[model samples]
Target: MPSQYRPQLLGWIDDLDKGTNYLSGADDRLLYANDNYCAFLRKTSSDQIFYLCISFICIIGSLFLIPSLIYSLPSCNNKAIYFLLLAGLVCSILILYVMIPELYQNLFTRKGCPIIFNRKTNKVYINESY
Candidate 1:
């Protein structure tokens, strides 16, 4: 293929492998179905995943700290520190028990992917098709 056509040819091949995308294959009805595009259905979905991971760490850390907190309470002789540690443990437990399920529902229960088209600039973007 000519050098100028090489990029377009490669793009076509890539689109074919990707199955369906707004920028390429599968016709109008299937334009919204692409693995890469579908993975990122919501713009903030990735951010939410990151937050969930961080929250998991917080829960684990608090669990491990409970023993240390109890060990320190006698030596430190501070009721406030003990209560604060207890509160942290409770809050972390609440987040795990409550927020984790909610996050799963909100993040994973999306119905379908959406293909976004910009009218003025004629640009296209894909979102979760849920």
Candidate 2:
């Protein structure tokens, strides 16, 4: 039979004696109480900042371009404005979708299968049974 494997949480240390996992940092914070590796694969502060910045730019561009497009509707023959308008609306919608906390959590947090430690075997396994 083929061996089964589970994904081990990276950058963490487990203590069977203490019955707790330690997360890396200056203070070495304790892992949160969860069977699943909640501490793994989190977005960094820099990533959050970048996402916010890009989202802001997209939103601002949409706000400006949309109004301009609406105001210029009398010139329906100008396909360029309509194209710009469509682009702006699409960008804004995409930004909003990305910013949605529920959607982000569902997509990034819940959907991933990560590696975790098998304490009994003293070996690591990739959690493919997600």
Q: Which structure among the candidates has the greatest TM-score?
A: 2
TM-score of 2: 0.40
Clashes of each: 8, 11
lDDT of 1 by residue, 4-92 (tens): 31123334335445445433332322323222222223324455567567766755675676567666656755788777877865665
**Residue 125 of model 2, lDDT score:** 50
The lDDT values for all models are 0.49, 0.47
What TM-score does prediction 1 earn? 0.35
Give one digit per residue, the lDDT tens place, for model 2 in 14-63.
Answer: 43224453333412223332443332323334454566566566556656
- Model 1 worst lDDT run, 10 consecutive residues: 33-42
* Superposition error at 58 for model 1 (Å): 2.7
